[model samples]
Target: MMLDDLSARPASVGLVAGWSFPATVFDPLVRQLPGDEVVAFDWSTFSSDWLGRGQEERAVPGLGPAVWVGWSLGGSLLLEAVRRGRIRPARLVLIQATPRFLAEDGWPGVSLGDWQGLRRAAGRQPVAAAAAFRRRFDLPNEPAPSAQLAATEGLDWLARLDLRSQLVSIEVPVDIWLAPDDPLVPVDWPKHLELPAHVHVHRFEQGGHAEWLDHAASLARSLVRPLADDPGARSAR
Candidate 1:
C-alpha cells in the first residue's frame, strides 16, 4: 500500500519494544507510520507481579482489534498473549523475533552457555552488559536508560519461554519480518518450524536486529502494505 492509502484510513497501532529498551526506541519508525494512532508499551511499566503471572492471568492493557507490532522479546510476549486469549488483534507483526530463544535439540537458537553468561553479566554489571549487547547488534551505544530489574526479568523470560508448539494455533493473521544478518535471531527458523498458512514471512537482505533505527520509513511501509491488502484487517476496522 502506498503512503497515501495509509493516511486515508487511520487505524490503531500498538507497539511493543524489545528487551531492556523503552518505547521511545520506536520514535523514528512511528514518524514514518502516518495516520495511525500509536500506543507504546514500555518495559518499565511491567511490574514484577505482572511478569510472574501465568499466560491466562497476564494482562496487556490498551490492546484491542488493532495492528500489534512487537520486536524480539516483545514479540514472544505477544504470541503468548494471543495464545492464552489475553488480547485479540486484527493483525500481529513480529520483527526479528523467535518462538524459542534458547537452542533445543534440533532448533537453532542462542547457546545455553551464551545465554547464561549474558544473564550473569547483566546481573553483575547491567550498563556494561547492555553496552556490549548494543555493540554486538550494531545498535546505538546509549539509546535509553533501562530498568535493571525489569531487564533481568526479561532475560529470564528469554531463557525459559518456548512457544514453538503454540505458534500455529493463533487465529490472527501474522507477519514475521526477519533479516538473515540478524546476529540474535537465527535466519533458518522458517525452515525448522511449522507455521500456519495465514502467517506471512518477509526476509530482508540487510537490516540486522535494529532495522527500525536505519530503515524506519521502508519498515513502516512494509508493515502497512500487507494490511492494506488484507480484507479481514479492513473489515474488522
Candidate 2:
C-alpha cells in the first residue's frame, strides 16, 4: 500500500478529501501511515464552519508545508487555497482534477446538460443523485460511497463554489495526475487548463476519477519524488 511505503520516508504529507467523499474513505491509507508522516485535511471537519470568513492557513501546522495529494474536488479546493494564498503545500499532486468543471461556449469541461441533470436528479431524489455520481465518477474498482452522505456533501459543494479563474495565481509546484479513462472529470479539461507557469501534469493510462484511491502509494511516490528530489530545480512548471 502507499502508506506502507510512505511510512518509511522522512517527509510530511497532507491528504485532501475527494468530493462527496468522507474522511472514512481514506482510513485504509491513513491508519497505516506513520503517525507522524502525514496529516488529514478537508473542508468538512476543518473549514466547514469557519469558512468564508477568509482562509484557514494553519490547516495542518506540524506538517510543515505538506505535500498535498488531492483527488477530484479536493484538487480544486487545494488550487483555490493556493490561489487565495491561504494554504501553502510543499507540493501539490492533483489526482483526476479539473480546473473548470462546468462547460462554456468555448470551454469543454462538462456540459451544461450534465450540470443541470445532476442538479435536477439531486432535487428529485438525493439517493439516486448520489448513485448516479458514484457510477459516473468513481471507478469500478474504487470504494462504494454512501448515497445519503454523498448527496449531502454534494449539496454543500453546490452551495459554495467557483475557483476556476484563480488558476493563473497558483505559484506552488503542482503535478496533475489525470486519468485517460476518467468518465467524470475528463482528461481534456486539464490539457486545456490555463494554469500558472508553475503547474505541471502527468497522466494515467487506465485509472478513472478515483485513480489515486486504487493506487495512492504509487501516485504519492510518483508525485512526491519530483518534489522531494528537486526542491530547488522547479520543473518546467
Candidate 3:
C-alpha cells in the first residue's frame, strides 16, 4: 500500500514484516541502506492475499525481482514466495527465519506448549490476551514467527501449498541471518531446512527476535550488509 506513493528508484528493497510486528521496526535498518530504501509491505494479511492470488500472480508492482528482506515469519515468507514463484527478487535476505515451525515428536525445535499456547491464547482469549501470548511466543528464544502469516483465509491457502522441493527452483541468491538466542523458532529448526546452493547464512551474536532492527546495529555492519561492500559476493558463492 505504501508503494503506491513511492516513486520508482533505480533499485529498492521490499519488506514484509512478521505477524503483528508492524513495519516501523525496519525504519532504522532500512534508513541505513543506500539510496532512499523502501521496505514496508502489508502485514501478514497481504501474504494471505498473495497465496490465493496464486503463484502465477504474486508479483506486486515494483516488486518484480526486487531485493526481498524480512524478519522471522517475514523471512520464511520471502523464501516461500520464491518457491511458489509468487514473486522474484534480485536478492533474498532473511533474519531469523526458518522453514518449518511445528515440531515433530523427535524434532528438538518447537514444543507443544509453544503451539498449543498460541491456539489457546488466540482462540480463547480476546485481543489483549492474544497480544500478551504473542509477545511471549515471539521472543527469539521461542521461534514462533513474530507474526503468524498463514492464519487467514488467503494465507491458509498458502500454507496448504507446500514447496520443499521447489526451493531449488528459485534462481536468485538467498541469504539467511539467524539469531542464536531466538524464542519462537526455538533451535534446530534451521538445521532441518534445505536451502538452495545460492543461499548464504550468517549467525548473529544477539538480537533474538528483531535482531538488526531492535537488537543492535553492530550486527548489521558485518552480518546483514555484506552486500553494501560488494553486492556480487553472494551470487559468486
Candidate 4:
C-alpha cells in the first residue's frame, strides 16, 4: 500500500509534539502526510498551566480513525492518554519514544541523577534549559515563549512517569521508530521493549533524537504504506 491507499482509508491524520516542542515542530513532516487533513496538537493551546495539571483537564480530542504520530515526550503522553482511555487511534507512529523514559531494572534510559539535573535546570532556568535541550537534539529552530514552562513541567513528568505496565493495554498497532545514534534515548533501548508481535520496530542507523524532523520526508514515505507492508525493510541498520 502507498500514500494514496492510506489517504483513502483515513480522512484525517494527527500530529503530536514532544515535550516543550509545539505543533509547528512537525510542519515539515505534515506536508508529507499523503493527501489527508492533518491535525497538529499544540500543547500550548491546552493551557499555560503546568502539563501535569493541564493535561488532565481535557481528553485528547478525537480525529476520527487515523494513524496518530508522536515523537519523544509527545509519544509518551499519547500512550498515557490511551491508557487513561482518553482516545483510541487506528494506528500509532512513535518516533524516538519509549514506554519508560527513566532507566530502571536494567533498562537503558536517562539516569536518575541526570534527570534530576534536567528537572532543576528546566524549572529554575527554563529559557537556558530549553536552549540546551534543543542544542542536544541539534534542533535549529527557536521555541515558543511558553516552551520553557512546558519543558520544565515535561522534565518533572519525565522524572516520575512510567508506562511499561501500560504497554499491554494499548490495543492500537504501533510503529516504533528508534534512532540508535540518539544521545538521549539509548541505542539499545529496543532490546528492553517487550512488545506484541504485531508491533513493528524500526531502527535507523544515522539519526539523532530529532530524527522524525530531520528525516521527515523519508519517515512519512515509509509510514504512509500499510503497517505490515514492509516489516523488516528498515528494522536493522
Highest-TM-score candidate: 1
Candidates' TM-scores?
A: 0.83, 0.75, 0.69, 0.81
In candidate 2 the C-alpha lDDT for residue 178 amounts to 75
User: Cα lDDT of all candidates, in order?
Assistant: 0.71, 0.60, 0.54, 0.67
lDDT of 1 by residue, 7-30 (tens): 545357877878777777888878
Cα deviation of 21, candidate 4, in Å: 1.3
How far in Å is the alpha carbon of 16 misplaced in model 1? 0.9
Please report the candidate that would top lDDT against the real structure: 1
Compose the digit string of candidate 3's lDDT tens values, residues 1-237: 122233434256677776545566566655545435555764565466554465466565455536777776677677677776687777777766666555556444456566555555544433444357456655332223333432332223223434445554557787766665677555345455556677766655554565555533432332334544533222222
Candidate 4's displacement at residue 150, Å, is: 3.8
Q: What TM-score quantifies how close candidate 2 is to the native fold? A: 0.75
Expressed as tens digits, the lDDT of each residue in 137-187 for candidate 4 is 686554553544455666765656688777755678878888867877776
Q: Against the true structure, what is every candidate's RMSD?
A: 5.1, 4.7, 6.6, 3.9
Q: Arrange candidates, best TM-score first.
A: 1, 4, 2, 3
Q: Which stretches of candidate 3 lie over 4 Å from their true place?
A: 1-10, 34-36, 58-65, 105-108, 134-163, 186-190, 214-237
Candidate 2 has its poorest 10 consecutive residues by lDDT at 228-237
Global lDDT for candidate 3? 0.54
lDDT of 2 by residue, 91-191 (tens): 77776777766666665566667767777777677656766777766443234545544555544463345565666556667787776667767776654
